[model samples]
Target: MLLDAKFTIGQRFKHIRIEKGVSQAQLVDGICSIAVVSQIECDRKYPSAELWGKLADKLGVPLRELIGMQEKQMEVSFQIDMVRVYIDKADHTHALELIDELEQRADLLEHQRIELLICRAECYRTARVFEKVVELLVPFLQNQQIRQNVEDVVLCDTYNKLGNAHYWLNDFEKAYFVFNSLDPDDVHFKISNCRCWNTLGNRG
Candidate 1:
């Protein structure tokens, strides 16, 4: 299934509003009707940038952070792409430096942990550090809290990363099992499944 690349402006507003425990009436502060605010939240209508600024001011999130969500997404994607490039170039040292920077962030939120782990795991995969990947990922997999709230794309990536670690270690049984657990429609699952079968067929 296709997913939105970033949160909608209204969605970012709604999440912060709920987190801050601010009511709709309180948020609008007589500037607009609660119905209008609700419509904005549902993405059925547009809220002017000025109005969004006011809402962001009340919600305690930076206006740029909310309105520029797509910008932030691009920034993050570029960072990850750089890491991947480093790995492909056999520059594990630089890739680890980048991963370490992410790990050092004191305010990393729950939603971001999985993505960071995925990046680090990719570096480890390139380094052929299979045991390190297993060490980092197994606990993430078993974390009830993370599993309960993980995005579908992240979940699929996690499965592929872990399965590949096992696959590279000659643990074909476990590797195929994890690959099979991924969502059938996910590209990660399909690619991993084909590799698993092809490898097994060659061995046979």
Candidate 2:
């Protein structure tokens, strides 16, 4: 089936809107109702070709620029999703193989690469490969490039996973240190806090 169109209409709309620096209300401009614009941007409805052309014109991008080609990036996303499914099923070896292949082919956007690394690290964690998890994640923590591009949630989760690995390896001191590196307000820190306390209690 034509791969169900790799690019979603909403993603295209949002991308174009960001590129144009136009708000949805501004874009509507009475050509369509604001509610209709909101719906279209949210992918509740696909715009007709006429509307799409109007949007492209206003955004000053070629219509093709708004649409993604169903090629390498889409295939990488599909493979990552499949690996997630396998990971959820506790199929670590299969997921690792898939991740290795996807990582080779993945022309991942910066954020996506960080997410994929976190996912792979979690897979290692699940398999009790504590040292491997640490090895995979520590460099990212030290990486200026990753720090520049990674969101706070991804950073926090990386710290939390690294802490878990240390905890598994009986390195309670390092686990405590890594867990403390996360913000107290972060959700991942909250989850890791409980583990940290439990580990500390046992160590004491």
Candidate 3:
């Protein structure tokens, strides 16, 4: 399973427990300590098979049901991995095709959706389809929940790509604004900034 899939499972597990009115102490009373339960629910640790079975019983669900979630996530992860490979090879046509399929899947967790959008925007940017890149990523970057939930690296990459799209379109004002919004301490941001400067100098 993808690392983000583990995160999704943890978040979904917590949501289910809350909806069922099962307290942390109540859920893990016999199977494990509340600390262990907390760790699992927070994505800090994975549960053992024995623990998974006990938790499933407590929640009145089948173990296979829980396992099924992981399987679906793994399947999605494989497709996303293929998208990355296609992007790396400059195969934007194929990358966009896979991204289109990913966008239609309702089972994708929030982080997965964010990743798909980023990948699609990148394909557009690489193909010199700057208008499409901006159209695709602008709303995603505007969502506060998405910005807060995604990893720093993912966020950085999104900004970098958006900034580059603006730069290519000769929208330097927006490009600078986007680039300046990133953290100065991030190595990715610094590299992106340098690229922007180089592009500007070349034009000058």
Candidate 4:
């Protein structure tokens, strides 16, 4: 499956609007009907070029800033696909190199940045460099600004990876804590938690 950013123009518009504390009525106050704001944010309707420009102006952002991310997200998605291929082939060196290059670029969106960090951590884990995985993801999870932007599924998987990294590093206490922090009913971590419990029991 392709790694998609999944943040559409409508989602972007809504995200920025909410972040700026702009109500839907406020967003469309002079530009268009308030009902159109919901349509646009829901992606049920696309704004006209004139309306797009006006909305951007009202939001105090450049017009391109609103439209440019879609293009960049496509590019990041393609690059992520390539990284996945390299990783699947066990070419972690190349994967890490590409991930590092992407990391250095300043244009990455929040979701894209989080995806790359998780990819980097996965590479480190596959290379048996668990410390590097912990080093990379621990600080990321701790940062509320960054962590809040991640999708729930991605966040669940990230927590699982981080917990496993801790487990492999023989930091059982930290591993247990991380595992326990996951929702008990989360299907994503159920098997992982079982393994964790079994390992801890054996070690105990």
Q: Please estimate how well model 4 matches the true structure, expressed as its whole-model Cα lDDT.
A: 0.74
* Residue clash pairs of candidate 3: none
Residue-level lDDT tens digits of model 4 in 1-204: 112247677877877788788888887887899889888889898765556667877887655456443533447666676566557656687678778888888888877877888888888888889999899878888894454877667778888888889888888888877777778776654547476786577457
- Clash counts per candidate, in order, are 0, 0, 0, 0
Instruction: Provide the global lDDT of candidate 2 against the true structure.
Output: 0.70
Off by over 4 Å in 4: 1-74, 145-147, 187-191
The residue-by-residue lDDT of candidate 1 on 21-67, one tens digit each, is 99998988857889988997897866654565566667776554444
* Minimal lDDT window, size 10, model 4: 65-74
| Model 1 deviation from the true structure expressed as Cα RMSD, one decimal place | 14.3
CA shift of 24, model 4, Å: 54
Ten contiguous residues minimizing lDDT sum, candidate 2: 64-73
Position 61, candidate 2: lDDT: 67
Per-residue lDDT of model 3, residues 48-122, tens digit only: 545665786798754444433452344787667656656765768767777887889988998888888888888
Could you estimate the TM-score for every candidate?
0.52, 0.59, 0.57, 0.59
Question: What residue runs in model 3 are displaced by over 4 Å at the alpha carbon?
Answer: 1-74, 145-147, 198-204
What is the C-alpha lDDT profile of model 2 across 11-64, one tens digit per residue?
Answer: 666866876789877887856887887887687875654565567667776544
Q: Highest lDDT among the candidates is held by which one?
A: 4
TM-score of 4: 0.59
| Ranking, TM-score, top scorer first | 4, 2, 3, 1
Runs of candidate 2 with Cα error greater than 4 angstroms are: 1-74, 144-146, 186-188, 202-204
Q: Give the Cα lDDT of each candidate.
A: 0.69, 0.70, 0.73, 0.74
